[model samples]
Target: MNKPMFGIDFGTTNTRIAFYDGETVELVKIRNPDSGVDVANIPTQAGFDEKNGNWHFGFDAEGFKQPKDSMKWMLLRDYPVEEISGTESKELVTLFFHHLKAVVAEARADEYEGQELSHAVLSIPVTFSLEERRALCESVEAAGIVVEQIYYEPVSALYAALRENFRQMPIDENLSGRIAVFDWGGGTLDIAIATIRNGFLYILKRDTLLRGGKDFDQIIVEKAMQDLKSKYNRHLDSYIETAYHQKAADLKKTAERIKISLQNRDNFALNYPRFIPKGAVNPPVEEDINLNFPVLKENLRNWIGKDIEQGIELLKECICQTGIPLDDIGLATRCIILAGGTSNLSLIEERLLEEFGTLKFGPLEKIERVPPIETYSSEPRRFFSSDKFGREDDASVATAVGNALLAADGGIPTFTCDIGLIVLSPTGQPYPKRIFQEGSPLPIDKPIIRQLPIINRGQEVISIQIYFQSIGYIKGEFEIHVDVKEHTVEISFHVDRYRILRVSGTGKNYPKRTQQSQDAIMDFPIAFRLPEKLKT
Candidate 1:
């Protein structure tokens, strides 16, 4: 019998995994072996135990006295970490996946006893580059699970939403509309504009911000510190500050809890022991931090409100770029899909509704209510109809569930490229040319070939370097010794579903370019260009 396939949403704040057992799709619950607490999502956190010199993950790592290292979106960027090495980050991610595999094994022990969990479909943010995707696949593969395919996060959510809400809407042979997915999570906020034509989702534009719920938490923490200083007329001692800095993981958890608790309530109290020092006292003092909804709301608006406005503006730009009229957008667009844990905040929904004016899912008053995590299910019908629209936790794991569904159904129709492809000129200077523009459909079966003439007579070798306009690094290059008689060389580029670039070159005199072709497999890099777009 074939092994069951799993879908994983490796999110910034939390990670979720679901399995497809031929007939039914179920969200796997990962329980902390030490705490015995069943959690639908695991925190994407890891730490090194000082005493044992061993690495821990998820809840175990979060509970450590020392600060936990979070690799969240680090894989997407080339930023070097002073403390944690790249290998360590990969190992941590691998350990987390190993834990997920164990959980799935334990859950299916009865029906598929002693069966090894293998194949999986992973979901990534729309803005993830080819390099980031490859790094993620490598990490998961290191954990012993074979990654079968990768789906974009918003695309997966769209699939789940369409599957569940299909019965509620009109079933037409030609169903076409736009869906603006506002996915704001812990470490990143990605606003994507996609169109559904003939039952397939195509991304028109995607704008990403390297800011999200974590930024909100930081704002809250800073605000709380300021408030405490003003109220108590006391500052945190250097020692206390150092200690709290070391416990960033715990402090962040506290801030996040307060933020969530204040979602529905008017006020929430954030209390911490030994938070500040009382005038030369050897021992630090505790603080009872009370933050009202209005004050918290105002603070959020004052700090991150500009970012929210920018997000909405980007949405409008996407609509404009897609040639969708502003007035018709409300009707032409099926719904404004909100996914990711940060979307739970009423402010985000309010801002979007204020701008767009039409949300297919429902109104703010109707969809803002937070549902208990236990109410979540992997079944499509039960998943959407369990509540009026859907559960609050749905935003957290919808991507994972949808990925499992796509994997089971042999995946969906969605493009992968996000930036224009370019190559270096023969003059040794980097000259940009668009081989394939962003938002193009994936699995390009036909190769894009370009012919370069050997103008320099008696040149021993001809070298071709490929580069992506967005990604600064050289993707791949090949060199062929000049056959004095040959006039031109043919360079062909083929990008697969996984965004892996396959470049091959053939000379008229040299029929055997197989070895050179094998050496041209390189993951293309995507450039960071949101700020550049905003500036323009």
Candidate 2:
């Protein structure tokens, strides 16, 4: 029997995994040791107990008295990190992955007991560079999980949405059209435009913004701090800056609660008895914080309104890149799927509905204001009784679900971005010629061949400049040299199922003029991208 290949969505705020064994796609629910609850997701966090020298991860780590270390991005970016939780950042990431592997093993113990846990189809943000992807893959592999492939998060999310809503299996040839996915998660906002034609999903354009749900939470926290200072004339900033770190963390949690509550109600009372620990403040300075403030939906809108507007503009740009007119988006778009935790915000949904009208796939939910949360209770309680937050049972899991479908051979992926060459003329002018356009199905059997004349006589070297999406080019264009009086060079390009680009080049007259073969082959991941240094 083949080892099961799991689909992993290593998100910025939370991580989720699924498994597909050709028969069924199982969304793996991780057991949180701290809560003793089986959850479909866990925060992407790591913490170390300084007192006992024990490590914690996910919900367990979130409950740590000490601040949880959220530095996976630092490792992914190859940032120069000195230390995290007394260990290197990369080591911490590997440790987190190790914990994930263990939990996954436990979750599947009934069926795959003692089976080696390996092989994953991981999904990543489209903006992640080759180096960043490699770093993430290496970290996961260090935890003994081999990465079989890395797919774009938007593509995975779209596939999942399609399966969930349309019940349209990927092989169904009747369904085809333009669709957009807005994935606003905790760390970033990813917008993608894709088209389905002839049973293949082709990503047309994808863009991302650094702002997301976490930023919205920060905005609320800042507003609360301002309101507290204005109303009570008491400040916790000094204490937060000093040794009272827990005060800040707890306040941030309160802000998050307020944000979620305000999503369902017009106003929510932020009442926390002894909000700040008694000893944190000195006598004659201030009393123990019994914070009481009312946060309105208008306030929440005012706080995150601009950011939401910016995200919508970014989404518009993504749609425009697909040659879809902004005015006719509602008519042209078959569906606009909203994924990610932040997509639950009413303001975002309102703005999208206003812009695109009623979507063809589903009706937009009207924002219904309800009574605020009961502040009369003595202890703190969650905004919602059901624990889970966000629309459609949480959109963050879409990527992992779709990745599982792909692993089960339930979807076919097409090239989302274009691959082309920049031809430099004798006059130093550059012209771009596309080899494979967006929407080309993957695993191309025949290679597209191109022959270019040597511009200058006795030109010993030929340079082939390749680019993607017309913005970024692969660094170091293919440089093939010839010495046998060749006047032209022949090049061939093809993309495999894994989206790896294969390039083969040869001097036209090498076989006749020289004994040495001049054939050269180069392989590059289509996902690989670098800032364009030359125009293409």
Error of 2 at 467 (Å): 5.8
Residues 326-423, model 2: lDDT tens digits: 78665676666777767767777777767665443343222121122222110111111133332223666778877766655534344546777765
**Candidate 2 Cα deviation (angstroms), residue 136:** 1.1
**TM-scores, all models, native as reference:** 0.74, 0.74
Q: Give the clashing residue pairs of candidate 1, or none.
A: 470-527
The numbered model that scores best in lDDT is 2
Flag clash pairs in model 2: none
lDDT against the true structure, each candidate: 0.61, 0.63
Worst 10 residues of 1 by lDDT: 527-536
